[model samples]
Target: MKVRLGFVANSLSLWDASPAKTITYKRYTELPKEERMDRLQEVTRLNLEHTKRILYLCAAHEIELYRLSSSLVPLATHPEVEWDFHTPFKKEWRELGDLIKKFGIRASFHPNQFTLFTSPRQHVTDNAVKDMVYHYRMLEYMGIEDHSVINIHIGGSYGDKEETLGRFHENLKVLPTHVKEIMTLENDDKTYTVEETLAVCQKENIPMVLDIHHHEANLSERPLEDYLEAIFATWEKRDLVPKIHISSPKSEKAFRSHADLVDAGFVEGFFKTLKTFDQDVDFMIEAKHKDLAMLKLIEDLSTIRGVKRISGGALEW
Candidate 1:
């Protein structure tokens, strides 16, 4: 079995290379009318440049999986703000896309927690669709819409799992079919268990991105091993390996929170279970330390007897 590792947005190795820089709407309004769009463009330009730098670093290190920051363009889906973010940055987007394709990188986006289709309010569902379009537009502009994916949680149970899940299917109709094709669902730490999430993914015919820490924090009645085959089955439609989220808990008291680095001991059993399956998988490290955590974990895991360091960010066992 082999696993390719990656990290979340922002690499600590680079100085001031955060791709999530933002300009608040209030700040935008404070600017003079003539300077409002210019300010937005300025921030976006810096963000795009920083994102390109991060992608270059990834390619140099052979890191194939990366999660793009959702805030690449500020106020992109806001109802009131209407500024062209594409035409001005066509070259930047194309360059980033080119780097990703050249390196065979698997770039993806995970919208904020509010981007969910299970909400009962029509406005909430509308906002969800709009937010999805915002992410999709970024991929489309980069010419990676066909290969990238957008991952989101199963969302709040809203006091009734059965009713809320049914509402999820009904509310999801608002999203376009093409957008839904690249969408994936994940199990949340508090609300949705792996069983519930897998059932929903099966019903919706969408892929599932399993979070190991979340499963440990909020466990279901059956063990995770029982659901592994079904969870992996969700990715059959997509011609890609199954992806999982990896993180260690902050502490016993704040168990659901992510720590700065993943504790190898905490995931040893999970790794053992994964080794039983003869398949390739991708892991997105969700620690607070970002790229540093991913590299550190790779070094720690390489010491194992049967594991071989195949690349800067991949291992085979």
Candidate 2:
């Protein structure tokens, strides 16, 4: 069995290298008409450049999995500010895709919490579709549309879980089939449990991204071990390995919040459970410390009896 680990956007080791830099709509409205588009383009260019730097850093460290910042382009999905983010930056996007392909890295995007399908309003669903398209366009421009994934939660249960899930199914239809093929649903900490999210994934023929910490915080009636096989099975249609989100709690009082570094002790049982499956998986570290957290967790996990550090970010058992 093999497991590769990676961090989320914005490595703390890199100074001023956040790919999520953006101009607020308020700031954009205040700018002169001539400078508005230029400002958006300028921020986007910096973001693309920073993204390239992060990709190089990942390659240097042998990190094989990364989640791209969805905010790569300012006002990308805004109802009024949507502009051509692809035309002027073809070279930059291609460079990012090339780096990812050259390093054999598995890149992905996770849209924000608002980019969900279970909303009750038509405008909300429309915005959700727009947001998904925005994400899809980035991957399309990068020329990695087929190789990458975009993950989201099952969304809020509203007041009625059954009715909301039905709405979810109905609203999901708005997404284009091609984009939906690369979409994944994750178990959220507050509402959706592993069982529910896995069921949705199975129903939709999408992959499930098990968030171990969320599973811990939000208990399900069934044991996690019971869902292991089904969870792994969801990724069978996809070419990439199954992906999991790993994080630790901030405190007992704030159980749902992510800590700076993942505590090996907190995840030991989950790792043991996964070891029984005899499959390869990718761990996307969701800690506050970013890359440093990933490195620490790698070192921590490699100390287990059956695991060996195969590279800076990969382990074999």
- Candidate No. with top lDDT: 2
Model 1 clash pairs? none
**What are the Cα lDDT values of the candidates?**
0.92, 0.93
For candidate 1, write residues 139-200 as lDDT tens digits: 99899988889999978888998999999999998799989999999998998999999999
Clashes of each: 0, 0
> Candidate 1: where are CA atoms >4 Å away?
none
TM-score of each predicted structure versus truth: 0.99, 0.99
Alpha carbon lDDT at 279, candidate 2: 85
Q: In angstroms, how far off is 241's CA in candidate 2? A: 0.6
Local error of candidate 1 at 136, Å? 0.6
Writing each residue's lDDT as its tens digit, candidate 2 over 64-107 gives: 99999998999987888889999999999999999999998899
